[model samples]
Each structure stands twice: as structure tokens, then as C-alpha cells.
Target: MAENLPAGWSINGNGAEKSWFRRFEFPEYARLRRFLDGLAELAEATGVHPDNIGFGKDYANVSLTVPSSEEEQARLGDFVSRLDRLFEEN
Candidate 1:
């Protein structure tokens, strides 16, 4: 099943070669940490892993760079949507 993304999620950075960025605010760092591992797993399961994650005390800075290939872009979109929904549940 495809996950739903939250409103106002925007694309940042320039060019497909550069990493993509999204900012999300969660309840707390502990909860965020717990969920991120699961989220990373999902990314791997789908074969579209995030490049790096910056965890703040209460927020997350996610950066992903899927290849320009159509399949990778699709998978990347799916990953971001899932993350958007996961945030809602937490």
C-alpha cells in the first residue's frame, strides 16, 4: 500500500544529482529515533535508501538522493510519502 504525504512538503536543492531535503517535526527525539530505524528499513526494503539523516533534539532533517532513473525516482517518492504518513501516526 502507498502511504499518504502530509501537506506542504516541498522539494529542495537543485538538480537530480544533488540530495533532496525535507523537514519534519516530531514529538521528541526518542520517538523520532525509534521511528527512523523502521523508516530506514522500509527504504532498504524498497531498495531506495536515504543518503543521510540529521536528527535534532525534536525534529528531523532528511536528505535523499535517488538516481535519475525512473524507477529510483518512483521509489524515492514512495519512500517520502511513507515517511510523511509515518509522522502523522507518531
Candidate 2:
């Protein structure tokens, strides 16, 4: 499942406890805030939310559950790609 992760993402745990994680960094607080806002909107739009989200003044740590099925893995990949795009845009 780790192989399915997008660039800059890592896998944690194993089996049912497996998850994908990424840390996004921003040059400033305002950009970080904007990225977080975009993340919230993405979750709302996709009906998929991160299992854990931690943030500071210039960074956010996001963790998302890794589903076992291929279909779900594809969905997760798309979500992750969008997250990467959000980071780039912000």
C-alpha cells in the first residue's frame, strides 16, 4: 500500500492500522492558513476527511486512513494529488 502513495507522502503502521501521511510546509502563517482552509473545503467536497490534522504557524501534518480495496486506494490517490495541488497553489 505504501507504493500507492503520491510523492512526498509516507506510509505508517501496517494492515488495518495502515495510513498515509504527509507534512506540508509554508513560508508563512497566512499561506498555511489558506492551505488548511482549502483542505477543509476538499474534505467537505469529497466526503473524505483526514484521520489526523495537526498544524502550527507554518506547517500542517495530515494523516489519512489507507483503505484495503483498489477502488478506495485510487480515490485516496486522487485526494492526495489534490492536496499536493492545494499546497502548490497556496
Candidate 3:
């Protein structure tokens, strides 16, 4: 799971509860809102939603579960990469 995580993301917990987490910060609320909206759209399009998403006016904390299967791990890696792209685009 550590190998699959993108830069700026960290792993938490152990066993089945293990997850990848990242906190994104924005300069302003509007930018944060746009990022959150894009995240929602990405989740819908990819069907790889985060396990938990918590946000304030200028930051968002995203957590995605670590799947046990190798196939799922690959998908998660792809998803995490796309998420990084989305953040850059926003």
C-alpha cells in the first residue's frame, strides 16, 4: 500500500482499516469549493470514492481505503494519480 500512495499522501491504521490520506489546502474558500466539486465529479466518473472526506473553508482531508486485491491496488494508484492531477488543475 505504501508503494501505491502518491506523493503528499500518507498511510494510516492497519489491516482492513488501513487507508491512504491526504490533506489539500487552498488559498481561499472559492478555490476549495471548486476542488471539492471537482472531487465529487471525479468520484462519480471513476466510481472510486474516498472512504471519508472532511473539509473546512480552505482545506480538505481525503481518505481512501486500501484494497487487499492487487487489481484493486492498481486501480487505487491510478485514482490517486488522477486526484493529484485534479488538484493541480483546480
Candidate 4:
């Protein structure tokens, strides 16, 4: 299941059923802020919230969960794909 996640994301074995985690690094706080803001907007628009989102001066972490249903899995995949795109854009 972890094999198919986006480039930098990985499954969190310590988490409940369907959890994925990813951390990103930025050159500065401004860039990190932009990434986090965009990610928050994306999550809100999709009606899915990551379980955790941590940000520092130069890095950020996000954890996402989707229940084990087919529809939820599809939604998760789409969400991650959009996330990856957003990462590239910013």
C-alpha cells in the first residue's frame, strides 16, 4: 500500500488503519508558509483534513488519513496527487 504513495510520502506504521505521512523542506520560512497555506486550502476544499500538520522555519510535516473504503481510497489518491502538484507549483 505504501508503494503507490506520492514521491516523498510514506505510510505511518504506527498510525491507525489508513494513514500517510510526508515531510517537506523549504529554503526559508516564507516558502514554507506558502506551502502550508496552500495545503490547508486544498484540504479544506476537499473536505479532508490531515491528522497532523507541523511547520518549522524551514520544514513542514503532514499526515493524512482516509478510511479503507474504495471511495475514500480514491479520494486520498486524488488528494495526494493534487498535493504533489501543489508542491511542484510552489
Candidate 5:
């Protein structure tokens, strides 16, 4: 499934782990904050939140997982696609 993820995203752990994660880097704190704020708004509107969102002055880490069911996998894939587009646009 990791092979199906968008560029810059990858599996967080080895075999049996279902989570995917990506770390986004910014040149400064201001840009990082703005990016996170936009991501938060998207998450709220979509109701598909990351399992974890961590950030420092220059980077943000977003992680997510879908349950084992096929429907959940589809939903997660859509959310991930949205996230990738948001990152690119921002």
C-alpha cells in the first residue's frame, strides 16, 4: 500500500503496520504555522483527521491510519490525496 501513496509520503513502520506519515519542511516558523493552520481547517471540514500532527519551528509531521476494512482504506486514500494537494497548493 505504501507504493500507492503520493510522493513524499511513506509507511511509518515495517510489516504489519498500517500507518503512513510525511514530514513537511518549511524555511521558517511563520510559513510552518500558516501551513498547519490551513491543514487544520481542511481536517475539520473533511472530518478525516490525522492520527498525529507534530511540528517544530521548521517541520511538520502528519501521520494517519485506516482500519483494515476496504471502505476505510478508500476513505483514507481520499483524505491522503486531499492532504497532498493541500501541501502542494500551500
Candidate 6:
């Protein structure tokens, strides 16, 4: 999972579910929340959304998934590039 992360991001194992991982932490929680909300909406509009999106912590954890593997890879590329910019701003 860490290898699949965008540049400048890293992941660690959490005590709970094996899927639990942390990415870039934002200085402003509200801004990050807003960003996550918009990202979710975008995914919905695209018709291929993530399976899970857990927030409230300093970081946003998004589990990307799609019924089709090809579409998932394409969306992942776009999502990764967008996420890298947020990390860059911090």
C-alpha cells in the first residue's frame, strides 16, 4: 500500500484494521475536510468512487476501489496528482 502512495506520502500500520494507514497531515483540519468532501463528490460524479473515506483526524484516509481494474488505475492517476499538490502546499 505504501508503494502505491503518491510521492511525498508514507504509510504506517495502525492497531485496528490492516488497511488503516496515514498519509500527509494538513495544518488546517477544516481545509482538509473540505478538500476530502469535494474529492468524494468528484468520485461520485465520475461513477467510480472509493470504498472508504475516513476523516476527522489530521489526515484524510481514502481507500480507492472500483468494480473495473482499468478504470481504477486511470482514476488513481488523477487522484494521486491532485493529492500530491495538497501535500506540496504544506
In candidate 4, how many clashes are counted? 0
Lowest-lDDT window of 10 residues in candidate 4? 10-19
lDDT of 3 by residue, 30-54 (tens): 9899888888998898889999999
Tens digit per residue, CA lDDT, model 1, 2-80: 2233364555565655566777777777778767877878877887777788787777788886467767667777887
Please write out the lDDT profile of model 4 over residues 6-79, one tens digit for every residue.
Answer: 68888775435557888888877888888888988998899878888888799888888756677887888888
What C-alpha lDDT, on a 0 to 100 scale, does residue 37 get in candidate 2? 90
**What's the TM-score of each model vs. the native?**
0.75, 0.93, 0.93, 0.87, 0.82, 0.55
Candidate 1 wrong stretches, greater than 4 Å: 1-6
Model 2 weakest 10-residue run by lDDT: 1-10
Clashes (N, CA, C under 3 Å) per candidate: 0, 0, 0, 0, 0, 0
State residue 81's C-alpha deviation in candidate 3, in Å. Answer: 0.7
On residues 3-75, what C-alpha lDDT tens digit does candidate 2 reach at each position? 6558899988988998999999888898998899999999999888999999988889999999888988888
Each prediction's whole-model lDDT (CA): 0.71, 0.88, 0.89, 0.81, 0.81, 0.56
Error at 49, model 6, angstroms: 1.2
For model 3, the superposed segments whose C-alpha errors exceed 4 Å read none
Give stretches of model 5 more than 4 Å off. Answer: 1-3, 14-17
Model 6 C-alpha lDDT versus the unseen true structure = 0.56
Q: What local lDDT does model 3 show for residue 37?
A: 87
Q: What is the lDDT of residue 18 in candidate 2?
A: 87
